[model samples]
Structures are given as structure tokens and as C-alpha cells.
Target: MMTCIVIDDEPLARSLLAQHIADVPFLEHRGSFKNALLAADFLSKNQVDVLFLDIQMPKLTGIDFLKSLQHPPKVIFTTAYREYAVESYELQAHDYLLKPITFERFFTAVSRLQVATPKVIETPIPETATTPEHIFVHVNKKHIKVILEDVTYIESIKDYLKIHTTKETLVIKERISHFIEQLPNPPFIRVHRSYIVNRDHITAFTQQDIEIGDIEIPIGGTYKEEVLNILKAP
Candidate 1:
């Protein structure tokens, strides 16, 4: 079992991560701290396998704290900001999870740490059978239910996202990358840094862009290879 701890300045964030760690079968929750300093003291004495750490904090940032350690445990940075993604990976962080994290995304990250064990391999479930059909987004002080099948594409606007569905467009305070975690990948794919399109809604595509109805979304150069490969596959 991997022993883990959460270190975040937000009480709610810490609580949420602790709960997620508890829900996972392979992870054991060791402790939760409000700051990296408190966690550093605990780490001096105990052996921790992983750390769910927040990037922005009061005195010391998560990145700085990890740099100070001579032998730091594998860290998974949890924060609201996406700017530090490159630096986090440079630190050899196990994962970088955005705020408003869902259980599905959290599980996907932690499952990478699971040890391989010989077992009967089972056939994968079909997308129609297993893909989540809907997601609730906090909008207008209410949790609005959005049918995944209705979403044509998602566009990033500053710190918010404009979710365009067949029925209407809903703007919400969330990062597109963070919101993508709630949707399954086969039907939902990020074609650009600012956009994610549902393959089901895509009517046509080229080397540079994709067409969904009358709307045309650019395929970012960085994402071009993977996007073409997935779209071209049988």
C-alpha cells in the first residue's frame, strides 16, 4: 500500500484530497497539513510514499519545498493554476492535478503507481456501455446538468470555459483542461490548447482544423500529430 499525505493551504482542498485518498484501494492516508513546513517536519520522521501538494501557499511554495528536500517522496502537485505545469514535470512530479478535481481524474493519476500483478485479463467495456453520459457544472450559483452527447466543443476564455452544446452555450468559471477530466477521451479530444471537441460532433477535419456544423476549430501545432493519429485510426 502506498502511504500518502495531503498538504494544501485550503482546508477544503485538503479535506477533499484526504477523502479521495481514503476511497482509493491501494493508497493509505497518513496525514493532512495546512502548509509544506508542517509536512516537512512529519516527513523527517516518517516514510511517505506520495504527497498530494498544493503549489501556491503562504510562506513556502510547493515547488520550493520539494527543492529543499534531499530525498523527497513522489509528489503530485494539486493547485488551481496551470502555469506551473512545465516546472512541476521538471521536478519529476508524479502528476499535476488542477483544482475542482474529480474522483475519476484522481483515480487515473494514482492508478499509475499501482504495482503490476498477474490476473485474468478481461475485455474492455464498450464506450457506449461505460462512458459517463453527463456532468454537473457550477453555473449561475447552481449545478447545471450537461449531457455529454450534446456538447459540440469546449472553448477556454481566460479563466472560464464556454461550453457549446447543441441546445445552448453555458459559460462557467473553470479551466478547459480541468473540465475535460469529467468527459471520456474517445468522444472528447483536445485539438488545441484553448479547445476540446467531441469527435462525435465533428463533421470534417483537415491537417490544420476541424469542422463541427458551421464552426471551425483550429488544431494546434503542438497537438497536431496526436490529433491526426487518433482521427485517422480505424
Candidate 2:
């Protein structure tokens, strides 16, 4: 079972989340706190599998508290503000739930957490084995295998992602955040909120945009530093 804690100043919100936790068979509710400071203290002494954190709180805001952690647990941000969504993703939050959260929505978020969690393979790898060169994605009720080397870029369109390969573009109904976690690093890097480009395909780049073939993708302000570092790496 996955152990979790709720950190929110609102009494009603805490109570409601506690009830939801009890309803989930795979989730064990460890504790609930009214502030980030209290939660930090508890976290220092113990570890949990997941954290349901509020974005805004007195003394220390949730975002600031999360940033302070050297090794943070999987976090699901529970907040009333929609503006914090982008920042939450930048922090690699497991999920974001808006205030007045329903049981259905909460379930969906946890379900995603379960799916995103990496599984361990006990089978041993051969000494000469190499990493898989392709990834399979579900599209139109069929699993389509994509060559990693051929992918030029990925574009997020609402709830779906457009995977642009050397041959063609495939539209898959999946979140960009999900792809970010699943895709291999090095060649793939998120340049913008809506774009993930293959560094191998990048013929040119600037502080403002990245050029892959003839398509120029904007570099988000928040992602500039990481993008530049990756591009400059030897």
C-alpha cells in the first residue's frame, strides 16, 4: 500500500481528503497537517509515498516547502489557484487538483500516480544488452511502436500530444507531463510548456527558440536555463 499525508490549512479540506484516502484500498493515510512547517517536521522524521499539499499556506507556501526538500515524495498539489499549474509541472508534481475537489477527480489523480510509478524488473540483463531503441504508445485503440531516433519533437495540444517523427506525426491522447516522465533523457528535453524537442534534431537554438528542421519552437522563460545547459553539454 502507498502511504500518504495531507497538508492543508483548511479543516474541511483535510477532513474530506482523509475520507477519500480511507476509501482507496491501496492508499494508507498516515497523517494530516495544517501547515507546511508542521509537515516538514514530520517529513524530517518519517517518509511517505505520497503528499497531498496545498499551494498556499501561512508561514511557508507549499511551493516553497517543496523546493526546500532535497528528496521530495511524489506530490499532488491541492490548490484553489489555477495559476500555479505551470509551476507545479515545473516541479514535476505527480498531479494537480483544483479546490472543491470531487471524489471522482481525486480518484483519477491517484490512478495517474499509480500508472506513473516505475516498476522494478527482477530479470537480469545480459552483459552485452543495450537499451531499447523504441517506445510503444497507444493510439486509436492500437499500440504504435515509435523509433526513438526518428522523433524530431513533441507538441502538446490540450490533453493530447503530437509526436513528430522523421516520417510522420502521431497524435496520442496523453499528457505532456506523462510523456516527460516516460521518455528517455539526453536527446529529449522540454524546451517550452507545449514542446519537447530532440536535441539531435536541433540544427539551431537561441535564448528565445529552438530550430529543428524548419520548425522553430519557443523556449519558455521558466525552462530556459535547463534547455541551454542541456544544449551546451558535451
Residue-by-residue lDDT tens digits, candidate 2, 42-148: 99999999999999999999999999998999999999999999889877788899989999999999988888776656899679976568999998899999999
Tens-digit lDDT track for model 1 on 1-234?
788999999999988999999899889999999998999999999988888999999999999999899888778899999999867754657678999999999998887645221233498756677777898999999999999999999998767999999999999997554566567989899888789999999999999999998999999875798899999988
Worst 10 residues of 1 by lDDT: 112-121
Error of 2 at 216 (Å): 2.1
Instruction: Tell me model 1's lDDT, rounded to 2 decimals.
Output: 0.86
Candidate whose TM-score is highest = 2
Candidate lDDT scores, in order, read 0.86, 0.91
Give the number of the best model, judged by lDDT.
Answer: 2
Clashes of each: 0, 0
Against the true structure, what is every candidate's RMSD?
9.8, 2.6
